[model samples]
Target: MIEFEFVKPSTVADAVKALAADGAQALSGGQTLTPTMKQRLATPSVLVSLNGIAEMKGVTVGGGVVTIGGATTHATVAKEASAYPALARLAGGIGDPAVRNRGTIGGSIANNDPAACYPAGALASGAVIVTNKRSITADDFFKGMFATVLDEGEIITSVSFPVPLKAAYVKFDQPASRFALTGVFVAQYAGGVRVAVTGASNNGVFRWKEAEAALSANFSASAIAGLKVSPKDMISDLHGTAEYRAHLVKVLTGRAVSAA
Candidate 1:
């Protein structure tokens, strides 16, 4: 590991200020960040620890919407299942207990790992990412693999998800690590339907407009039958072939809709 200075900022303003310093990186749960540091893949000159900031650490539900602090852990979300069962399920499905206890929502989204489950939830639920600066829509937040619209020194404060009428997440794990080889999130709201897929695409997360259209017409498992996803766009690796993942996308979408 590279030698670096660590700064634990007690407030959001301080954290942001620290992050503004040259070659600075934000640390939340450190589930992904620390490992990268140890591997020498990431070597920030300064580490701005957000753990000291009390403002970024809770879950709130009001006016039919759910607001989650960026630093909120997956374990907390899972333990508070009664608040949003589907979201809790999504949280519980990430990594293992130790990881869930340490991995955070902001960390997950900020990293934007292709196989991470939270991005699917955010995209499907039309969640808003609230940062120290401006709010970004889920669609506009994710750029690509391990990338987001977050600028230098920007710190995500919280995420706000509008409560849906019904929602569910289904995923096929990669076995050893339990990372999603292919995952799907389906949400049915009064306005319409939203379907988001993760783990299969190189682009990280993407919407299934065809499936969404079909579900909006008739919110049923059979509704997704006519939707076809091209294998050409999916990622092919040791877990499964691109063709196989394409098939899983359709299969998982069916299962998610049926369960919903």
Candidate 2:
């Protein structure tokens, strides 16, 4: 790894200030970024660690919502987020034990890896992405694969998820990486049902509106039996074809709804 100055800020304000410097990069959990740095794909002059910020490292549930600190790890969520069982289940299944213990939710959301589980959970749960500057709805926060509206030096403070009446997430793993080849998260709330698909779309995690509309009318697997997901916008790669992923979108949606 390239030599770089490292700073561990105890507060978000200090972290933001440190990140404002040119060539500074935020380091959370070090699950993804560290590997990139070692590979010379990322060579920031300064590395600002978010792990020391106490405010960004816990879980709280109240008033029909679950709030997770930005720096909270997948293991933390899996252990402490009992109120949102589906979300906790999703967290528990993210990866092997080592990854679950080290990967932060904020980093996952910020990276917005198309095959990552958190984006699907956030988008389907109608969660709010809280930042140092302003709060953004999950719908507006994600821009595309490995992209978000977070500006330079901006930090995600926490994420607030409005607990749904019923929800479930199901994914077909990509084996070696355990990343999703195609994943679906289904949430049913009083307002309506929301279905978000990840690991399948070329544009990143996205809502399946047609399935949502059908499931909203009837919260059951059969509700979306006749519906189909177009392969045109799906990702085609060595693990799976666009057509195969698109098919999984529908199949997994059914499994999720049934599981929910």
Candidate 3:
């Protein structure tokens, strides 16, 4: 990796200010960014670490919402976020012990990796992404693969998830990385049901509106048993074909509903 100035800021404001400098990049868990840096793909002049910020490192639940600090590690979420059992379970399944101990929910959300597990959960839960400047809904936060609406100097401070009446996440693992080959999160609320799919699409994490409508009417595995996502939008690679991923999406969504 290239030489870079590293600063561990104790507050979100300080971290945001530090990231305002030219060529400065905000560093969260470093699970994703560090690898990119080592590969010489990203050469930031300065690294602003968010781990030291005490205010951004805890989990809280109240008034039908579960709020998790941006700097909170996966291990912390897995251990503490009991109010949202499905989300906690999702956190616990990310990568391995070392990665779970180091990877932050905010980092995972910010990176918006196509195969990452958290995005599907967030989208299905209708999460609100809180930043130093403002709050954004999960639907508005994500743009596309490896893309988001986050501004240059803005930093996500926390994420607020509306607790669903019933929810579950089911992922078909990629084996080596443990990243989702095709993951589905199903959440049923008082209003309706939400279904989010990840790791299968070229456009990144997205909602399955057809399945959502079907499940909203009848919340069961059989509700969407006949539903199918077109293979055209799926990501095709050596691991699996677009058709295979498309099939997994339906299968996993059914499994998630059953699990829920």
Candidate 4:
């Protein structure tokens, strides 16, 4: 790991200020950040640890919504989000015990890993990303693989996800890293149904509009019959081919809807 200064701030304001300094980067659970740093892929001059800020960790629910602190660990979400069993399941299955204990929801989404589970749940559940500057809708927050709309030095304070009538997340894990090769999250809300596909797309996590429309009309696994995901926009690698991922998307979507 590259030599770097570490700063632990007691408040969000202090952390934000520290991050504004030259070559500064934010650190939550250090799951992704730590590994990248050790690989010398990320070498910030200073590391601002958000774990010292008590305000950035916890979970709360109100008005049919689940509000989670940005620094809240995956284990916390798995234990707290009992109201949304599927979400809790997703959190519980993120990584092994170590990764789940250290990885934060903010860290996962902010890093915007294409195979991450939180983004699927956040997007499918119609969550809002609360930042120091402003609230960004899930649709606008995730830009692409390992990317987001977060501005320089901006701190994500929390995320608020609306309670869905029914929801389920299904993932095809790659075994080693346990990252999804292709995953699907299905949700039914008062407004309509939502289908968010992750891990398969080359661009990033995205809504399956065709499946959404079909499922919204008939809320069931069989409703997505004949619906197909194009392989042209999917990722092709050793773990899985574009055609394989596309097939998994449809299969996972059906399973998720059935489970939901």
lDDT (Cα) of model 1: 0.91
Clashing pairs in 3: none
- lDDT of candidates 1 onward, in order: 0.91, 0.95, 0.96, 0.92
Residue 148 lDDT (model 3): 96
Please give the lDDT score for candidate 2.
0.95
RMSD of 1: 0.9
Per residue, candidate 2 scores C-alpha lDDT tens digits across 1-260 of: 99999999999999999999989999999999999999999999999999999999999999999999999999999999999999999999997899999999999999999999999999999999999999999999999988999999889999999999999999999999999999999999999999998999989999999999999999999999999788998999999999999999999999999999
lDDT per residue for candidate 3 within 1-78, as digits (tens), equals: 999999999988889889999999999999999999999999999999999999999999999999999999999999
TM-score of 1: 0.98
Residue pairs in collision within model 1: none
- Put down candidate 4 lDDT per residue, 233-253, tens digits, no spaces: 899999999999999999999
- lDDT of each residue in 7-65, candidate 1, tens digit only: 99999988988998899999999988998999999999999998878899988998888
Candidate 4 — worst ten consecutive residues by lDDT sum? Answer: 220-229
Order of all candidates by lDDT, from best down to worst? 3, 2, 4, 1
Alpha-carbon RMSD to native, per candidate: 0.9, 0.6, 0.5, 0.7
1 versus 4: better TM-score goes to: 4
